[model samples]
Target: MTYGEFWVHYLRAHQRTGTRALHYTGSVLALALVAAAAISGDWWLLPAAVVVGYGLAWIGHFAVEGNRPATFGHPVWSLVSDYRMLLLWLTGRLGPHLVRAAEER
Candidate 1:
């Protein structure tokens, strides 16, 4: 699927508030790790960021969402969409995405 198509699927996969919350938490922690790595020059933290971020998200996908992640097919777009979704959630603008996702379903 194209990025736009994958985004719609991503939104639907993350329809649950709990899943979104986990993703947000993971994204925030990943960002912090990146900043920390930059500040302390601990390059290892960069890999840790991927582990911490995708780990939590995958748990939510398997346990909460009961589905495979969109990343399996579209890794780059899925990663970008994760941050976009997190940004929208932080800005209190995720409701519209959720509505649109539900409509698609």
Candidate 2:
């Protein structure tokens, strides 16, 4: 699927507010972890960041949403979409995207 198609599927998979919140939490924590790793010179936190971030996201997918992750199909796009979703959310621009995605479903 193209990136646009995957985005629609991605948003559909993350329809629940709980799932999105978990993703937001994970995304923030991951960013903080990377920052900590850089500032502390402890490279271990890098991998830990990946685990922590994706782990929370996975937990949301399995425990909360009961769905497979879009990551399994499109890792690179999924990664970019995660951060893009976060930024759009931060800027109050996510609702329209979500609405559009919902319409597509």
Local distance difference test values of all predictions, in order: 0.90, 0.92
Top-TM-score structure, candidate number: 2
Tens digit of lDDT per residue, candidate 1, span 32-54? 99999999999999999999999
lDDT of 2 by residue, 1-105 (tens): 788898899999998888989899999999999999999999999999999889999999998999998889888898898999999999999999999998886
Off by over 4 Å in 1: none
Superposition error at 93 for model 2 (Å): 0.8
Taking all chains together, the TM-score of candidate 2 against the true structure is: 0.96
Could you tell me the C-alpha RMSD of candidate 1 in Å? Answer: 0.9
Error of 1 at 46 (Å): 1.0
Off by over 4 Å in 2: none
